[model samples]
Each structure stands twice: as C-alpha cells, then as structure tokens.
Target chain A: MKQSQLIKGVLEGCVLAIISQGETYGLMQALHHHGFPSLVGGTLYPLLAKLEKGGDIVSIKKPSPDGPARKYYMLTPQGKETFQNFQHQWSQLSGHVNQLIDEVHSNDENPGHPG
Target chain B: MTKTQATLDEINRLTEQLAPADQAYFTDLQLYLSTAGLFYDEAQLNDQLLNMLLDLREANQHGQSARAFFGNDPQTMGNHLIQQFPQPKLRDQLGLFSLLLGISWVFQILSSPQTAGGLSLNLVAFILVPILEICAIILIIRILHTSIYPNNHHQWWPYLLTGLIVTITISLIVILNSWVTVGWTFLIPDPWHTILLAAMAIGATVYLLGALLHRWRHHQA
Candidate 1:
C-alpha cells in the first residue's frame, strides 16, 4: 500500500495523540520526525478543519514566542473518547495481522515437511 | 531582530521562488480556511507551508525530488469550504430569475413591434413582460434584504432605496405617456422604444411596492 494511504488511515489518531500533550508548532516538527516528513500545511490544515467541524477538536489563538500568534488545537472530551477507541482498535488489528504473518512464515519454513 | 523572525523572513523570500500557480494554490487555501472560520492567522498557515517547501527544496538538493506542491484537488477543497455555510437559497433563486428575465427582455427587443396596425404589441412580449417584471421585482426585493450582488449586508439598504426611487419615477412617466408621439426612434430603433416603455412600467411598479413594504417594515421596527 502507498505510504500516503497508510498515513491517511492513522493521521487523525496521531494528531489527536500529539494534541493531547499540548498545541505547539513543535507538533509539525514532531510529525515530520515521526514518519510524516512530507506532511505539509495543505494536508494538515484541512484535516484540522474537518476535526474542528466534527467537534473532535477546538482551537484558540495563542502568541507564539518565535513568529506570529498560532492557533493551538485541543481535543474535546468526545475526541479523547474517540482516540481511546481508535487505540483499542489499532492494538487488536495490529496483533491479528502480526499473528497471521508469523503463521505464514512458519508454514513457508516447513513446506517440505508438511504431513 | 529575533533569530526566528529572521528565519521566517528568509522562508518567505525562499517561498517566492515557487511558481505562480503554486503560490496561488497556497493563497486560495488560506482564503478558504479564513472564510470557513479557522481562527489561525493567514501568515502562520503560509509559514507552515513555506517550511514544508524549504524541506522539499533541501531534499531535492540531496538528490530526492519530492513534489513540494500541495497536491490536493482544488474542487474538493472548495466543496469542503462550501459545506461550512448554509446553502444561499435567495441568491440561487435570484440567479435563475435574472437569467429568465434577461432572456425574455432580449426576446422583446428583437421581435418586431410594428405589425398589421401602426403600433402593435407582440404576443410574446405581452406574455413575457409580466413574468419578467414580476421576476425582476422579486430579485430586487431579495437583493435588498440580503444582497447577492455585493455580498455585503451593510450597503444593501441604500442601494435598494435608490434603485427603487429611480425605477419608479421613470416607470411612472412611461406608463402615463404610453401613447406619446415620437418623431424618431432616434438612437434606438422602433421595437426598442416599446421595449423600453414596457421595462419602465415593470421597473416602476417593482420600486413603488418595494418602497412601501420597506417603509412599513421600518415603521413596525
């Protein structure tokens, strides 16, 4: 699958996780460092807008030390709940996929000895 | 002054190297976001995008050519922006009314007014004139309440009132002297004369009724 498609699937949850700590421009740097190096304002702002529109997050303007004032996003209670559910689903889905891969690997290794 | 401010200025300068279409893409995105009620300043958004462009430029220098341009389809983004506001029903209706009124008015101007008798009313004009007049009035009323033309609510009242007064006065003169002798059609030809007279009558009634209703509402208020 395309990296962008993978990122698209979980970017919302990742954003929620980052925002849970604090809202900062540092979030952009963190996203870049954490595997979304190509993620730009074009993608991020629209995602943020959709989140705000959905009532999953809210923002307020705060003075940034470096440049102009920045809009800081904070998750609502509904957003937190949604993120927790996402985490739960991710854990289960990833675990099942891992097991399936492991089983496939073992079967390949023992292909000649199959009864 | 500050290190960060200097860096931002550098970033802004570097962003100028972007193609005009790319720059416009960013500009339009900023506008859409602002109109959609995003609270962030436009400069901040521009800065973030600029930083991304710088990163791509750096990568390109190192032999990796990432498309710095934001590849999102503008139409989809426009749709998202439009979803923020309710559908503008009055504006949409006015748009359709204006089109039909325009078509009928054009037909009136083109069709010959000189028939079996000296001066004859074309049957098409006879039917279309009333509909055109009614649609025009409705459009004016809608525009007065909340202008679809200017898109500014504050200036609508003045424009509406002035338009109403002028249309009514001219319409009154035309209606009163429907049979006045004309030496020449002059600048405009024969059919245009009847068309203008009909237009005046329609415009006058529309203005008079609009003024009365407006005054009545103001008095109530």
Candidate 2:
C-alpha cells in the first residue's frame, strides 16, 4: 500500500492519542514532534475539524500571548474511549505482524527448511 | 455588526500581518474555501480559517513559510475541510429561496409598465424567469470557483460553455418577457401594487434578518 494510505488509516488514532494527553493548541507541531513529521497544517486542520464534527473532540478558542486566539483541542469522553480502543487494537495488530515478520526472518535464515 | 462579520473583519486584519508570499497563499486558500459552496456553515468555516491564519502567522514567526507549514496542495486540503462542514439546514435554504423570490417579485412589479387601469404581467414568464436566473447565478458561481485554482486545467471550455448557456438563458427570458403574451396575466391596480411591493420588501427584510440572527446565534454557540 502507498505510504499515504497507511498514514491515513492510523492518523485519526494518532490524533486522538495526542489530544487525549492534554488540551493541545499546536496540533500539527505536536504530531510532528510525535514522529509524524510529514504531517502539515493542511492535513491536520481538516482532520481536527472532522474529529470535532464527529463529537470525538472539542475545540475552544483561547487567547494567545502573541497573536489571535488559538484553538485548543481536547478529547471528549467519546474520543478518550476511541483512543483506548485504538490502543488495544494497535497492540494486537502489531503483535501479530511482528510475530509473522520474525517467523519469516527465521525461515529466511534456514533457507532449505521451508521448501 | 453581527458576529460573523466581526469574525470576518478580524480575519482580514490578521491576514494582513502575514508576509507577502504567505498572504498570497492564504488569499488563494480563502477564496477556495469561501466559494466552494453556498450551503455550508459559513460561520464555522470563518472560524476555522481564522485559526488557520493565526497558525500560519505563528509558523512564519518561527521562519516557516505558509506553503511549508500548511503543505503544498491547498486544493485537496480545502476540499477535505469543506466536506467536514455541516450542510445548511433545509429551513435556511427555503428562507434564502423565499428571499430571492421575494426580491425578484418586487423588482418585477415595480419595473412592469404601469397603465391607467393597472399593471399586467405574463404570470408564467414572471415566475419562470426568476427561478432560471437564480439557477444560472449558482451555476456561474460554481464555474468561477472551480477556475480559481491555478493548477486546474481544462478551464477555458467550462467558462465558454457557461457563458454560452447564460447568454441563451438570458435571451430566452427577454424573449419571453417581450413576445410571449399568451400566458395567464396578473393585474394589480395602483393602490394594491404599492401595498404588494411594500409587503414583499418587508418579507425579504424579515427573512434577511432572521438568517443573520440565526447565523449569529449559531456562532455564539
């Protein structure tokens, strides 16, 4: 699958996880710091809008020290639940994928045994 | 001023503080988002845009350009943002339609030739022309909107086709007004014509105020 498609699938969960930490103002920067460096405001803002629309997150405008009001996003109860579910599902999926990769690595090491 | 107007004014003010390149990019994105449709929740869209502008300014302070901070493809991002906006409520659509129709009706009444007896109008043409004109306007807006993005190709043909269609529709309306006199006619004597115009003007004003109030309340919430 294309890398963007992969990111698309998990980006929502990643956003939820980030918001679940605390009220987040600079979401794009937060996502970038958290390892999704390629994410941009163009992508992040719409995703945040969708999450707000879906009732998973709420944004409150707070006065900024140096500019106009900034939108601070916080996870709703529904968003917290969603993040928890994502965590559980991610753990299971990663575990299965890791086990499969390890098995394939062992098979490759023992080249003649698999055939 | 209404909350929406206040928000828009603030947006414009903040937008000016952007660097020239960032200002240009923000203007393009603003046009794309605002012209995408008539039915989306505009107040919410403005709020989102204001927040975005603020973010862009902050990024610029840290040495990032708008394109760098917001990504290169604004069209795709704009589409995604618009998709998430709440669609206009059905009542709001009906209210807008009524206001448009009311304004058209008043104009038609006032513009029609007045005579000693009364003013006569071809009812069929009077009703059909306004609807067609409204539809034509919406189509023209959509056509113009799609051409706003620089990356969009196949632009000239759409404009040409739209111009041709609009010209034909307008000509048809004019012909119907001038030549087609066979349809049912309506007559309003001088006194009643004045009253009818007054009534329509009032109705349109009410609808306009109601819509503005609704938008203000929605923004507050």
Candidate 3:
C-alpha cells in the first residue's frame, strides 16, 4: 500500500488515543508532536468536526490562562468505546504482522534452516 | 523584519497566492484556531499558523501541490463539514412538494363539472384545504425542529407522523371529492373516481422521486 494510505488508516486512531489521555491542546499539535508532522490544520480540523458529529468527541469552550477562550476536545463516552475497539483491533493485527517480520528475519539468518 | 514580523509576512504572502476557495479555507482555519485552541498566548497561535504555512512551503518544495499538503481540496472538506449538520434543503423541498400537492388538488376540484347533492368544489377546498395547509406547515416546523436539535430517530417520528397524517388527509380529500363530483347519490362514480386515482398516483410518484434524489445526494457525501 502507498505510505500515505497506510498513515491515513491509523491516523484517526492515533488522534483518538491522544484525546483519550486528557483534553487536547489542539489535535494537530498532538499529531505533530507524535511524529506525524506532515499533517496540517486543513486535514486535522475537519476530522475533529467529523468525530464530533459522530458523537465520538465533544468540545467545550474554556477560559485559557493567557489567551482567548479555547475549545478543548474531550473524548465522549462513545469515543472511549471506539478507542477501546481500535486498541483491540490494532493489537491483533500488529501481533500477526510482527510474527511475519520475525519469521523473515530468522530466515535471513539461517537460509537453509527451513523448507 | 523581526522573526515574528517575518513569519507574518511569509504567511500573508503564501495566503495571497492561494485560490479564493483555498484562501477561504485558510480563513476558516484561522477562525477555528483563534476561537478553539488552548493557546498559551497569542504568540502560540501565531506560531501554530506559521507552522502551518511552513508545512505548506515544505510540501510545495517537495513537488506536492498546496492541496496535497491539506490532503483534500477545500470543496471536499467544506462538504464534509456541511454533512455534519442536517441540511435545510430537505425541509425546503418538503415545502415545494406541499405546494405542488395543493395546486394539483385545487385544479382537480375546479375543473370537474358539478353533480346533484355532491359537496361542491368550494366546500371541499374550504374544509380540507386549510387542514392540508396546516398539516404542511406543521410538517415543516417539525422538520426544522428535529434537524436543528438532532434527537436520533425521534427525528423520524415527526416525519412518520406527518407523513401518515398527510397521506390520510389526501386520501380522504380524494375519496370525498370523487364522491361529490360524481353525484351525491353515488358513492364512488366513474370519471371522478379515475381522476382521484390519477391524483394519488401522481402525488406518490412525485414524492418518491424527490425522496430518491435526496438519498442519492446524501450517499455521494
């Protein structure tokens, strides 16, 4: 699969995981600091809106210590539920992928070890 | 320019180069960040905006278009934003359908010749027309309320209740008009009977066609 396509699938799950920690500063910041620096506001904001619409997350305006009131997004009950589901799916899928990678590495070390 | 002023200048320059629609997207993002983010200070907000511009510049240098950096074009993103909110167009179309039904019924009543002892075109219209009009108004209100508030399939209740009421009302009007226009002595006589059937058929067909179009557009989203 294309690299961007691969990142696209897991990006939302990662964003949800970040929000699951606590209310986010800005989801784009979380994504950027987490190593997905290529993502921009145009992509991130719309995803946040879509997630809010789907009831996965909700935003509330709160007074900021130094600036204008900021909208902070917290995971809704539905969001937590979806995050748990993604966690389980990712664990299972990654476990199988890891196993295949390990097999490939082992085979390279001992080329004639297995038929 | 100082570092801060230089960042602002670069942002302005890049923004000026964008197509109007893309520029609108940049404006929307600015508004959103300004209103929503827990920025430590105004400086942080500016830094974030600067970062976004720098990312765009980097993407451009790497041979990616501005839209590629954004991942989707502005129009597609705008549509996604809209789909999160229920459209007013649905209610608008409902109004149009109600108008069409009213006009067709009025035409059916006025054009038919009078018969002995049957309810006159004026009476059927006077009695049922207002009721139908009221029903249409209620239906529109219900649609607006449910869409604005968004309470699950509770939204569907207004639709179902109003739909059932409208269907029953139209049937009663058709059956009554058919009775009176044919003759008071006859229950469901010839030409008016056929006309009533035709009206019902046409109304149902038109309504279904409208609903199908709505579904198709939404599915494309």
Error in Å for residue B156 of model 1: 32
Give the top-scoring candidate (lDDT).
Answer: 2
Task: Please identify model 3 stretches exceeding 4 Å from their true place.
Answer: A65-68, B1-72, B87-221
Score every model by TM-score.
0.46, 0.86, 0.43
Which portions of model 1 show Cα errors greater than 4 Å? A112-115, B1-22, B28-69, B81-221
lDDT of 2 by residue, A67-90 (tens): 667789999999888899999999
What fraction of the real A-B contacts shows up in model 3?
0.42
Error of 1 at B102 (Å): 21
**Cα lDDT tens digits for candidate 3, B42-103:** 44345556545555544556665556667655445534444454334556556765676676
lDDT of 2 at A115: 29
lDDT of 2 at B45: 84
lDDT of 1 at B23: 54
What does candidate 1's lDDT look like per residue over B80-107, in tens digits? Answer: 4445333345665566667666655555
User: What are the per-residue Cα lDDT tens digits for candidate 1 across A13-47?
Assistant: 89888888776444555687788987754466567
User: How far is A87's C-alpha from truth in model 2 (Å)?
Assistant: 0.4
DockQ of each: 0.23, 0.80, 0.17
Clashes by residue pair, model 3 = A71-B36
| Candidate 2 structure quality by residue, lDDT tens digits, B1-221 | 66678789889998898889888899889988888876777788889999888878778888999999999998889989988988789987887788788667777676676668678877877888889878887887787678778555776866797988789888988886777766577888878877877887798799899999978886796
Candidate 2 TM-score to native: 0.86
